[model samples]
Target: MAKNNSRNMSDQSSMNGYIKSICDIMRRDNTKGAMEYIPELTWMMFLRILDEKEEDEHLQSEAVGEIFEPSLKYPYRWRDWGSPEGKKRKELQEGHMDDFLNFVNDDLIPHLKSFEEKTNATKRQKIISQIFRNLTHTRLGSEKNLLDVLDKVDHLTSENIDDTHQFPLSQIYEGLLLKMGEKNNDGGQFFTPREVIRAMIRAVKPDVKHNGEYATFYDPGCGTGGFLAENYTYLTTPEISDLKLNASDYNHLKHDGFWGLDNSFTAFPIALANLVLHGIDQPHIGLKNTLSGRETYMDLFEGAPYKFDYIFTNPPFGGKEGDDSKANFAFKTGNTQILFIQHIIDHLAEDGTCAMVIDEGVLFRTNENAFLQTKRKLLDECNLWCILSLPQNVFVNAGAGVKTNLLFFTKGETTEKVWYYDMSDFKVLKKNPLTINKFDDFLMRLHSDKEEDKISEKSWYVDIDTIKKKDYDIKAVNPNIKEKEIPKPDELIKIIEESQVKINESLQKLKELT
Candidate 1:
C-alpha cells in the first residue's frame, strides 16, 4: 500500500496517465464505455495485487519457521499466466492468440471460480473465488490487445513504480469507481460524494473498537464502499485520530471494524478490490439485496452480528420496493428510504448512532400512513438530533438534481427537540462542488453545548411539540428569510394585457415603416 502512496501531484498525474493509457487500449477493442472495460480491468488488477501480497506473506511465514499455503497454485497464479515469460504463457507460445485466450476463458477462470465450492475453503480462497466468479470470458475483442493489457499489468509492481512518490492504487481505484457513477442514468441513483462522506465520518467518529471489543460499522446500501473506506482512512490517519492506536488496534480495525452490503454485482467485486487496495485485508461485504432478502453472495458476511454500533450510509432515493422487501419490516411501504429507516431502527444497537443521506420528501409530505408511522417510530425510538438540509444541485456532478438532507441520530432515546441547519439557500453548481469547508459552521455549532450558541440565521431548533403540531413535517424553513410579496391574479392578467397592447402598437409602427 505504501508503494501506491503519493508524495506529490506529479506522481498522481503519472498514475492517472498510466491508467488512462490502459483504458485507451481497451477502448480500441471495445467502447461501450466503462461498463465494459472497468470490470475487465478490475479482475486483472485484483489478481495481480493478490498474487504479490500472498508472496510477501509467504516469505514472512518462512522467516518465522511456519509453512505457508498460498491462495493460488502453480500455472494459475498471475506470474504463471499473466506475465509474458510465464510458464503458461510460454506453453501457449507467441503469435497463438487464440490458444492464449482460450486457456484463460476456458481453464484459468473456471479453476479460480471453483474455490468457493470446496467445503473447507479458506477465507482468502473464498474471497478469490468470489472475485473471479463473474469473469466468464475475456472482454478484449482482439487477442493482441489482450496480451498488451496483460504485459502492462504484469509490469505494474512496486519496484517498477517510483516508490518515493507513487500514487496509491487505492486512490487510483477510487477514480475508476467515480467513472462508473458519473452521469449514471438509472433512476438518478447518484454515488455519494467523498467530501460529503468525509464530513459525515468526522461528525460521528465512532470508536473502531466499541466497549473495549470489536465494534461493527455498517452501511445498508454501500455503493463501491465509499463510506466504509473513508471511515478507515479517518481512524488510521494520525492527525485525524486523537487516540494512540497500536498494532493490535490497527489489525482489529482492518479485519473486523468495517462491514457493508451492496446489491450490485457490478459494484460488489469492485468494492472488494477497492477495500483491499485501501489496506482492508478482510472486507465483510455481502452481495445481497438488503431490502429484498435476496442474495447473490453472502459467504463473506457469515458471522455479522444482529445489530451494529454505528451505521453510516446513503440509501437509494427515488426508488420503490416490492412486497417481499416491505413484508419483513414493521412499516409496510414502497418508499425505499422509509423501509430502510425501519430496517435501521431494528438493526441499530441500543446505543448506536447513524448518519444517513435521505430524500427531502421524507421530512414532509404528511399524506400516507407509512410515511407518518415511520417518522413517528423514528422520533419515539431515537433522539433525532440534527437534520442538515443540503443544497438542491449538490448531486449535479453525479447526474441527480433532487434536494437532499443529512439525518444524524442516536438510538435508545425519544426525541425532545431537533436542531436543524439550513444550507438549502446556497447554490450548488458542478463547477463549484460542495466541499467540507461548507460544514465548518455546522460542525462548530454541533459541538457546542449551549442552546443559545446553536441559534443563528441559518440554524435553529424545533421542539417536539411544534413538530407534532405540524404533523411531523420537519422541513427546515428558514425563519430569518423574508417572504416576497406577490400581486393578485387579476392584477397579473391586466399586466399581461398591457404588455400585449404594447407589442401590437410596436408591430403597427413597423408595418407603417414598411
Candidate 2:
C-alpha cells in the first residue's frame, strides 16, 4: 500500500502535503502566513521531524545506541493531550516544545480537572484536546517507510548538497524570492542573481587544496544563504550520468567549515532553513549586522585569526543614503558597497581570495566622496586579480539596468596586471529572468586558468599602472568599430529617392481613383 501510494503520488503532491501541514499550523496561530517567513516554519518543522524521528523504531534504536538518547520526556511528546485546560496551555507554550511536552503529558494530561477551573477559554480547551488527538492521527509511516524516503533524500553524492536538493528547494524558495522581490525591501536588495552568484563561485573555486587543513567559510551578507549555498554546490562534484545518486562532500565540509551572518530577521531563518534543507548538519548561522562596527558583532571573527580562504558575495548596493549615521566604523565613506568591500577585505585571511559584485559607480567615479581613495587602496593593498564587466539587463527584473562588475582580488600579493573579460555583450541566463544571458564562456575561461591570447576578441589583460593612471576607470578599452562610413550627400539623396518613389506611387493611385 505504501509503495502504491508513493508511486502514484507525484513529487509535487508530496511537497504540497508538507506545505499544507505547515499552513494549517500558521492559520491556527495567526502568525505571518507566508512560507518564506521560514524561521517560524523551520522551528515548527524541526520539532515535527524530531517527533516523527523519535517515534520511528529504527531511529529510536539508533538513538539509544548513540551517546545521548532522544529527549523523549521533553520536546517530542505533546502536553495536556487529554486535559480540559489543554488549549489555554497550548498557546502559551507553542514554541517551548521541551517544557510544554514534559508538563502536559506527564502532569496536566493526567490531572486535567485540577487545572480546568483555573484556565481561560473552556471551548478552546476542548478544541485543543481535539487538535492533539488529530495530530496523533497524522502518521509519517513506519521505520521502513521513513528509511526509504531518507534514502531518496540522501541520493546526492556531490560535495555540495545544494545542487543535490536544488530542484526540490528551488520550488520552495521561488515563492519566497518572488514575495521578497515584490516587497522592494532594502531597495530590492534581498534578491541576488543566481548566474552572477555562480560566476563568482566559479571564479573563487573554493576547494580543499585552496582552503588549507581546516578552512572556514563565511558570508556576512548571507541573504537567503544563496552565496553560501552556491559555494557549497561548486565545491561538490555533480552526480555522474550513470550514477544513481548525486555525489557530494557538503556534510563533511559543514561539520568543519561553513558559517554565516545576516541582519534581516526575515532572511535569517530562510538562510538557516536553506542550509538545513541542503543537508548541512547543525549549520553555524548567527544573526548580527555585518555592517555593524560594534565589538559584539566583530567578535564573530575572534577564534578564526586567519581570514577565509575564499569569499564570494553580492552585498546590498545603493541603499547607503537612508541610514548612514550608524554605518560600520571601518567605513569612513558614505557608500554602502565600499564599506562592505572594506569589511570583506578586513575579514579576509592573508592568503584568501574574494570576488564581489558592485555598482559600476565604484569603478569610474572620480569624486572626492572617498571613492577614488577606496579604488586606490584596493589597487595598492591587494592583488586586484580580475574584473569581469557583466552585461546590462542582468538585473532588469529587479527594475535596475545599472551596469555592474565582478571584482576579484586576493589579500597578500600585489597584482601587476589585471585580467579584464568583457562579458557586456554576453547573452543572458535563461533561468534567471532578471539577466540578459549567462556568460558560461567566461566561467569556462576562468576554470581553464589560461593566460590571455592577444588574438581573442572578448578578453585581455590590462597593466595596473595604466588603470591607476586612468584613476581605476576600467571601461571598454577597445570598442567594436565599423569598417566604413556613408557620406552625408549620398545618405540624403538615398532618403530623398525613397520619398519620391512613395510620392509617385500615391500620385498614380490618385489618377486611377479620378
Candidate 3:
C-alpha cells in the first residue's frame, strides 16, 4: 500500500509537470493561438497514452485501459517524412515526438514495406518533416525524459486529476465560453453555469446502478459537454461506491448511456475531449444542430429506438434568428428558450425525467407564443416535479443574470402537487465570504427527501395547481411587510436642505443654458 501511494504521488507530480509545460508553451506563444495548439496537444497526448497502453499488458488489464487503444488510422499513419510513408505519418502526428519517434521514424517504414509502396510526394513530405521537427523540439520532449514521465503519468487515478489539473484547460475554455457569450458568436446561448449543472445533476442523481436497467441519458444543447460530464462524474464518484462495479464496467455504462449534441464546431471537439478525459471513451457526442429542420430531425432519430430515462440540460437561452428557414419547429414566440423547452418535451420518453435550466422570463411572461404555454403543457401533459430557484452571482462570470430556475418534471402521469425549493439565498459567493458552501447543505436536504411544504427559512414547497393559477410563476415572493414612521420634522428639513443646495445649482445651470 505504501509503495502504491508513493507511486500515485509521483504520477500526480509528473502529470502536473506535463500540464504546466503545456500551459507555458501556450502562454509563451499567445493565449488565443494556444487554444488551437492545445486541442492538437490533447489529441496527441491521448494517442500516445493509447499507444502506451497497448504496449503494457498489465495496465491494459485495468478497466479504463482497454478503451484507450487507438483504432483509427488515417493514411497519415503510414507515411515517413524522409520517405513518402514517413512524411504522411509525420504530417498527421503534428509535432508530438511520441508518434514521430515511435511510429514514423522506427515502425512505419518496415510495416508498410510489405504493401510494396514507395514513398511519394517529396515536396509535401519535406513540409511535413519540418512541422514534425518543430513539434519534436517542444517542451513535451523535455518533460518526458525516457518513457519514465509517461509511465509516471499512467499511474494517476481519475480522482487525482479532477478539476485541479484541468484548471488551466478550464481557464482556456472559459475564454471560449466568454467569446461565445459575446455578441455575434451565436453560440453563446448554450453556455450554462456550472452551478446550475451541479444543481440539476444533484436533483436527478443519475447513478451506475440505474445504467442498463434505466432508459438513456441525453443533452440537446450540450455545450462544451458540461451537462454530460457532470452526469458522468455524478455516477462515478466515490459517493456511489456501494455500486461495486469494476472500472471497466463503469466505463462501458457511461460510454453507452450518455449522448449529446452541439452545432458549434469548436464546442463539439472540446465536448468530445472532455468526456474522453473523464473516462467515457468513445462518447456518442455528435455535431448536429438540435433545432435544424424537420428533415434533419428525422435524420437524427433515424435508427435510434431508445427513449431517454433522464434529461438534464441548459439549452441556449433567448430567441433564435427568425430568418433561418431550417428551424425544426415554428414557435409562436421568437424566443429560442421556448423552442428548447418544446424540443425537450418532444424528445423526452414517457417514463423519463428532465431537469432543465430555463430563464426566469419563461416562468411568468404571458404572451401568446411565450413559454407560459409550454409551462402549462408540462403541468397538463406531464408530471411537473420541482422548481429550484438558484441565487444571483451564480452566473456572474458569464455576464448574464437572467435569473434561472431548474424545472424538474417527468413524463406520463401528472402529479397534483409540485415541489418548489426557494434557494434564493443559496448564494454561491465569488470569494465565499461567509465561508458557506450552500450546495453541500442543499444536497443534504434534497437527498434526505425532507417534507418541503412545511415552512423553512430558505426552502419550502408550494402546490402545483396554485402555481398554475399564478401562470406557473415559481419566484418566491414573501408577503410579510413592516411599516415605520418618519423621523422628526427638524431632521427631515435638514436632509431636505442638503438636497436643495444641489437642486438650486442644477436650476441655475438650466437657466443659464436657456
Candidate 4:
C-alpha cells in the first residue's frame, strides 16, 4: 500500500508538471490565461490521444486478421506532422522557420476541417469535422511554440505514462475548465462543480440495460460534458458501487449510452474532447442551438431516439430565447429555463428520469404565463420527487449570483407531492467551495420509504393541492422556518416611549454632572 501511494503521488506530480510546462509555453506564445490556452491545448491533447487510441486499435485489428480503416491518412495523422522524430517533423525542423507554420496553417488545419464535407462521412469523421468546425486557422503564433506544445502533449501518451503512473488524462483538462469558469472567462457555460455533478448522479443512480434495451443518458446543455463524463466514471469505477456488468452492457455504454447537445460553438468541441478523454468513444454530441432550432452539425445525432431514458444537465441560467426559439414550445416566452423545462418534458421517454440544476426564479415567479404554465406542465406530466434548494451563491464560482435548485423528477407519473430538501442555510464562499460530503444528511433521508420518515426541519413534503393553490409555485419554502413577526404601531410607540424615558434619565444625570 505504501509503495502504491508513492507511485500515485509521483504520477500526479509528474502530470501536473508536464501540464504546467505546456501552459507556460502557451502563455508566452500569444495565448494567455485559462480561457485562451485551454482551447489551444484541448485540440493538441485530443489529437495526441486520438493517434494513440487509433494506433492501438490498428494493431489489435491486425493481430485479429481484420482490416481497419484509420481516421486520418499519411501526413494528416499526428505521427507524420506533430511527432518529434517523424519524417515531416524532421523536414519542418531542418527547413525554413516559416515552413512548419505555413504547413500547419495552410495544409493541416484545412485537411482536418474538411472531414465533414466528405461524400459519406464516418462517425469519427463527423466528430473530427465538428471539433475543428470553428478553427479557421491555428492559434499558436510561431512554429517553435506549436512544436513545443506538440512534443509535450505527445510525451503524455499511454506508452510513456505506464500503469504505475497512469493518471486519468481527463483530469488535465478538468482543472483548466475550472479556471475558464472563473469570472470574466466566459466559459462558465461549460462548467458545473464536479461535486455537484457527483451528488446528482449518486442521487439518480440511473440504470443501464435493465430490460434488454440499452439505456441512454442525455444532457440538453452539455457544457464541458461534466455530467456525462461523471456519470460514466460513477458507473464504471468499482469503489463507488458494485454494478455487475456483462460484456454487452459495457460495450453499449461505450458506444450508445451517452448523448448531448450544445449550442455554444466554443463548448461543442471541448465537450467532444472531454467525453472522449473520459473513454466514451461514440459520444453523440450534436452542435446545434437546442432551443432556437438552428443546426450547426447534427449528423452524429441522426439515429437518436426521439425521447431519452435519462437526462442529467446544468442548462445555462439567465438565458433568454428569441421568437424563433419560443415558437416551438407550447409555453411561448423568452425565458430560456422555462423553455428548457418544456423541452425536457417533451424529450423524456415514459418513466424516464432527469435531474438538472435550474435557476430558482423559475419556481416562484408565477406572474409569467411561461413560468406558471411550465411548472404546471412539469407537475401534471412528471413526478417531481425532489427539489433541493441548494445553497445561495452556489454558482458564484461560475460568475453567477442567482440562487439555484436541483429538480429531480421522473416522467409518466403525475406529481402528487414534492419532497423539498433545504440546504440554503449552508453558506458557501469562493474559498470554501461546496463538496459532496456536505450532503450527508440529505442523502441519508433521501431513501426513506415513508413520507413521515422523510419529514425534518431541513426536508418535508408539499402536496399538489397546495402547489395548485399557489399557482404552481414549486419553490422550496420550508414550513419549519418561521418568519419573524412585525411589531404593530402601538407596540412600536410604547417601546420608543420607554427608550425616550431612559434617554431622559441619562440626560438628567449629565446635567447634574455639569
Best of the candidates, lDDT: 4
RMSD of each: 3.4, 10.4, 9.6, 4.3
Q: Write the per-residue lDDT of candidate 2 for residues 418-481, one digit (tens) a residue.
A: 8778867655545635332355666667656455543256667788888878877765444443
lDDT of 1 by residue, 1-514 (tens): 2143333333656767777878889999865577777778888988888888888999999999999999889888888888877887888866464888888888989998898899888878887787777788889867789999887776667665655422256666776666765665332243677878887877787776776677788998987788888788777776775767789888987788888898887778777877787778888989998998898899999899889999999998778899999889887889999999998999998889999998898889789888888999999999999999988876644335578899999999999999999999877676777888988888888888987879999998899999999988988888888898798999999999999999999999999999
Candidate 4 residues 168-215, lDDT tens each?
787776767777667666676678888888889888877776345788
TM-score of model 4 vs. true structure? 0.90
Whole-model alpha-carbon lDDT for candidate 2: 0.55
In model 4, where is the ten-residue run with the lowest total lDDT? 1-10
Q: Which stretches of candidate 3 lie over 4 Å from their true place?
A: 1-20, 31-38, 56-195, 209-212, 240-242, 246-252, 294-303, 323-327, 397-400, 426-429, 433-436, 449-454, 478-495, 498-514
Scored by CA lDDT, what does every candidate get? 0.82, 0.55, 0.55, 0.83
* TM-score of every model versus the real structure: 0.90, 0.66, 0.67, 0.90
Cα shift from native, residue 385, model 3 (Å): 2.1
Clashes of 1: 2
For residues 464-494, what per-residue lDDT tens digits would candidate 3 score against the true structure?
A: 7678778777565532322467889999999
Q: In terms of lDDT, which candidate is stronger, 1 or 3?
A: 1
- Which model is ahead, 3 or 4, in terms of lDDT? 4
Candidate 2, which segments miss by more than 4 Å at Cα?
1-64, 69-188, 209-211, 238-252, 294-306, 321-331, 396-398, 426-437, 449-455, 476-514
lDDT of 3: 0.55
Cα-based RMSD of candidate 3: 9.6
